[model samples]
Target: MAKAFASQGDMADKKISFTEVGRDLWAFTAEGDPNTGVIIGDDSVMIVDAQATPRLANMVVEKVRSVTDKPIKHVVLTHYHAVRVLGASAYAASEIIMSDKARAMVVERGQEDWDSEFERFPRLFQGHESIPGLTWPTQTFAGRMTVYLGTRRVDLMHLGRAHTAGDIVAHVPDANVMFTGDIVEYHSACYCGDGHFGDWGGTLNAIKAFDVDAIAPGRGDALVGKALVGEAIENTRDFVDSTYRPAKRIAARGGSLKETWDAVRADCDPKFASYAIYEHCLPFNVARAYDEARGIDTPRIWTAERDKAMWNALQA
Candidate 1:
C-alpha cells in the first residue's frame, strides 16, 4: 500500500512546551513542530521565527503576554520558509529582519513556497487564510547585524548557508545562548529541500565553535547545558551527513531517483525514526541531496507543481 504524501495524514495536535534556555531567552517548542525563540530585553522583546499564520502567531503573542508585556518590536526570520515567515504580520512589529539572501529568495519564490508548504503541511497552516500574501522583511543585512534591546545586545549573524542560502542565527553573548534557526534542529528531521549539504556541515562546525552554554534550536526541546547543546549539534550534523551521503553515493553512480530515495530511507530511517518529520522530509531531502551531489550548487526553486510531481514519482 502507498502512503500519503508529505504530512497529509499528520493531523494530531502536538504538545507544545515553552522553556527558557537562557536568562531571558525562551523557546516555544511544539513537540517536533517548528520552534519559536523569544529574546526579552530590558525594554522590548524580539521573536526569532514567527509561526505559520497570524492566528498561530497570536498564540505565541499570548505566551508572550504570560511572560511580560514588553512590546514585540522585532521579528527575525531565520530563513524564508513560509511556515517560519508568514506570521510576521501578526506581531505588528516595528522591524522584521532577515538576511539579504533571504529577502532575495522571498522575492524569487515566496508565492510558490507559500502554496507548496501549505499543501505539504495542512496541520501547521491552521489559519492559512490569515497569511497575507507574502511576508517581507523590512530590514535586511548582508553578513551580520547587531541590535540592542535596552542594554541587552542581540547579535544576528549569517555564518554561512545551511538550511537556506541566507540562514541566520541569533547569539546573546551576555547569556552565552544562541538561537539557531533551522540551521540546527534537535531530535527533528532536517528538511534539506532547499539546503546545501556540504555547506550545512561546515555551518554546523561554525556554530559548534560558539562558547555558548545553551541553545534554542529551530525545533525540538531547548538545550540547557553545554553538553546537551553539543549533543544536539553533533546529532544534527550526523543527520545531515547520513541523508546526504547515501543520496550522493547513489547519484554519483548514475542511479535512478527512486534508488537514491530508497538508499536514504534505508540508511537514515532506522537511526532517525523517532525524530519529528522523519518521513515527511525524507523524499525532498533525498532529491536535494541528489541534485547537489550531481554538481548543482544552488538549490532549485520548489513549487507546488514540482512538489507534487516529485512526491508522486518518489512515494507512489
Candidate 2:
C-alpha cells in the first residue's frame, strides 16, 4: 500500500518540555513539534512563535503562569507559516510583529499556506475551529527592531532568508540567548518547501556571528550551551546542504523531479532518516531544491491541491 500522506499517520501526542535556557527565558518544546520561546521581562512577557491554535497556545500560557503573572504583551513571529502565527489570538497580545516581507507573504499566500499545512499535518492544527483567521502582524519592520519589556531588551532582526523569505530571530541581550525559529532546528527536519537554498548558508553564517550563549531552536531540544548551540547550527547547515547538493547535481543534468527525489533520499537518508518529520519533509524539500537548482529564485507557493499533486507524483 502507498504510504500515508504527509503527517496523516503521525497522531501520537508528543511529550511537552518547558526548559529554562536563560535566567528568565524558557523554551516550550513538544518533542519535535514546533517550539515556542518565552522571555519574561520586569513587567510583561514576550512570546516568540505562537502555537498552531488557541488550545495549543493556551498550553504555553499555562506554562507561563507557572512562572509569573506577567501578561503576554507581544507575539513575535519569525516567519509567516501557519503553524507559527495562526495562534496569535490566544495570546491577545497588544502587538504582533513580523518582518515586512513576512507580512507581505501573509497578504500574498497566507491563506493557501493555512490550507496546505492544515491538510499536510492535521495533528498540529488540533482545535482548528478556534483559529480566528489568518494571523496578521500588528506591526512590521524592515530589517531590525528592538522591543523592551520594562528593562529587558529583545532585539528582532531579519538576518537573511533561509527557511523562508522573511525569517527573523529574537535575541535577548540580557541572557545572550537567541530564539531562532525554523531557521535553526536541533534534530528535527528543516521544512524547506518555501526556503531559499542559495542564501540559506549566508543566513546561517549571520546567525553564527551572534555567538549566542544558548538558543531555543525552532524544534527539538532547547540548546543551553555554546557547544550544543554550535552543533545544532552546523548540523542544520549540513542538513540543508546535504539535501540540496545532490538534488542540484541531478537537476543540472535536467533530471525529473522524481529522479531528484531519489537522489536526495540516497544522500540524506543515511544521515537524517531518523530526524523528526524527515519523511514528511523529504518530498517538499526535494521539490524546492529541484526548483532552486533550475534557477527559480522565489519558491513557488504551495496550495493544498499542489501539495497532493506533488506528493503523489513523487510517490509514483
Q: What lDDT is obtained when candidate 2 is compared to the true structure?
A: 0.94
The alpha-carbon root-mean-square deviation between model 2 and the true structure, to one decimal in Å, is 0.8
Per-residue lDDT of model 2, residues 139-211, tens digit only: 9999999999999999999999999999999999989999999999988999999999899999999989999
lDDT of every predicted structure (CA atoms): 0.91, 0.94
Off by over 4 Å in 1: none
Which tens-of-lDDT digit does each residue in 188-296 have in candidate 1? Answer: 9999999999999889989989968999999899999989999999999999999889988888779988899889889898899889888788878989999999999
For model 2, state the Cα shift of residue 78 in Å: 0.5
Candidate 2: segments with Cα more than 4 A from true spot:
none
Per-residue error for 97 in candidate 1, Å, reads 0.2
Error of 1 at 178 (Å): 0.5
TM-score of 2: 0.99
